[model samples]
Target chain A: MVSKPPPDATRRSEKSRRAIYAAALSLVGEVGYPRTTVEGIAARAGVGKQTIYRWWPSKADVLLEAFLDLSRQAAQEAGQEPYAIPDTGDLAADLKAVLRLTVDQLLDPRFEAPSRALAAEGLVNEPLGREFVTKLLEPQLQLYVDRLRAAQEAGEVRAGVDCRIALELFVSPLAQRWLQHTGPISYDYTDTLVEYALHGIASQPPRSA
Target chain B: MVSKPPPDATRRSEKSRRAIYAAALSLVGEVGYPRTTVEGIAARAGVGKQTIYRWWPSKADVLLEAFLDLSRQAAQEAGQEPYAIPDTGDLAADLKAVLRLTVDQLLDPRFEAPSRALAAEGLVNEPLGREFVTKLLEPQLQLYVDRLRAAQEAGEVRAGVDCRIALELFVSPLAQRWLQHTGPISYDYTDTLVEYALHGIASQPPRSA
Candidate 1:
């Protein structure tokens, strides 16, 4: 249904797109979401305002794509396959590994400010918050859902457990600590979360890890 | 050194205090943290600005105390002992009971808006965020710690478990869902969280409960 662009034109467009993403991320971090404008993004990226409009419907769309791109970059930097959790036949180990990487990503200075700004705005701004969750957060969470389902199939997780809520046992604690400064986050902390989540905090340990 | 006020004056001040707290809660909920002001709260509450300043040093202080008072009120309404989880020799039942009350509190229209506004502000404002955790959140979380410790002593929870982080297994999930709109909040959901926290999501169920 669509014609492909020439390779040279595509390259040029890609360059502009990356620049726009960078500009959007930094601008949102510095000014916060309420003050971030499409024109400001276009000016910072050195693209025409019309060029931004050509790709994204609104500033929210631009910001969302920018954050999506950021997550992709962070995943690549960590040597993780984007949008996927490793399944090495050991659910606890795999979950722990992924959570440790999350700990790193959360503490990354480049990721922290913009994320906080966007999240803060999202709290009061319901439409934007839902969009952020739908476009950005939920996709990442789906990866965990996939991983847990696999574990269920392999008999690592109980059949009756809700994978969606199951993932939160480990994930949300780390999130709370990072988001609210509730506690210190470390590889050890995340490792504990995984262990606690998989085996539980009850007296009888379910199984040897 | 504290001087006792006359009983009649104290009664008048108590009424003014309740009015001020109500004003602070509603103003923050409607206008959000940045736009909310002491002057506006005083105007809405029908108190002089000096009356507010005499009690609380800042808007944040006013909001914090307002939240604290609100929590106490909610607990009383729920027929719960304020700030304490019950010990019925069944950790799971006790946790579920408290979390169900929390679920009710989170979904309350009176609690929701002001909480989201203050929490959103806290996400970016580090000092305010830290103060909120220290004064408001940690105190609440510590009650969980206390309950968890009691369970540990009762040999219900693992002795090796860190009660602080262990509480997060159930608590943070509910918190994240409410804060981010990631999922539905219900007594069923919270009860499931307690079950998952106690017995875990692994293949082998740990305990009979």
Candidate 2:
């Protein structure tokens, strides 16, 4: 359906949209997703329920958008595009820079509780788990895949390596530590991970003569 | 108050114990931790509620014992010594063999449902999560730490590396994949992880020379 919008109307819609996203994030973080209601989001947002309904089908949809918005803002704050990983022909540096930023985000109090709440819910709730991975997590992972692929082209990685799985060597440890509280995380640790992942930890290169 | 046991009572206690463990795992798997009750476990286990109280003091203790029992049986079937990582000196082969077995365990239908239920609960429930990590998980992970320590002593790994964190290179990826369903796991995938972990992925060897 094609709809026409005047400039003033569009600006008003954007303002309401920001309010809804903020309200949704705060409510979910405070009350959690299962208990969060559209009425609560509308009231906290200082908007009518119809306004939220016009933009989002449910609280789930609203929260998802709220999370996506948070992620984009985080990416911008990190001085990188939300969906791109820089490939300067130095894979280690790029990966380290990105992972360091991730460590910061994971440690940030603003991001911690809400994301954990959402992720916890996602575990018991399969559809939401898949949705978060597909929309939020997988896309960030794809940026790594793309950078690795470019590295493959540059002869910086083994020719036959699968970039998708390759990225996990460094990525998954941080993920498990954060999710399970298995260990501490730091930029130095992540940098070492990138070094170990890119080179080989066997004390000798696998492809060496 | 100290209680004394009767002669044939030992057999009765054993039978009730097995039933209790079974009931706890199945009930938690079906209904999750927050909903699984002491009364429900007792009823399902076909024992007097006081029988459970006579042994463990709480529902959490019941579930923890249930998981420990499950892990013990699985380890025995895998020909693994419970709570030990076999130190065959060849770290790569040892880790790969253990992880391949783990791949089987993670995919086992009997283990999958209950593990997921517990893990999902762990994500939101701090006390249960910490208890599982301390009693169940850390002990297993420490076996790897011991093996890694042995490797370091043998001059196979760098001196400064932390055995605990180093094990995560091979371990956590598989875990994240299993817990989050991020990717399919296989023998080759785990083998690759062990290789990447030991030598590292950096294109150059250590400058420590």
Q: Scoring each candidate complex against the real one, what DockQ results?
A: 0.68, 0.55
Tens-place lDDT per residue, model 1, A30-54, is: 9989999999999999999999999
lDDT of each: 0.91, 0.82
Best by lDDT: 1
Minimal lDDT window, size 10, model 1 chain A: A200-209
lDDT of 2 by residue, A46-121 (tens): 9999999988898888888888898889999888788788777788889999999999999987787778778777
lDDT of 2 by residue, B1-209 (tens): 86878869878888999999999988887887788999999999998899899899999898888889988999999888888778888878888988998999888987887788888777667678888888878888988889888888887766777677778888989998888777778998898788767756444555554
- Model 1 stretches astray by more than 4 angstroms: A205-209, B1-3, B204-209
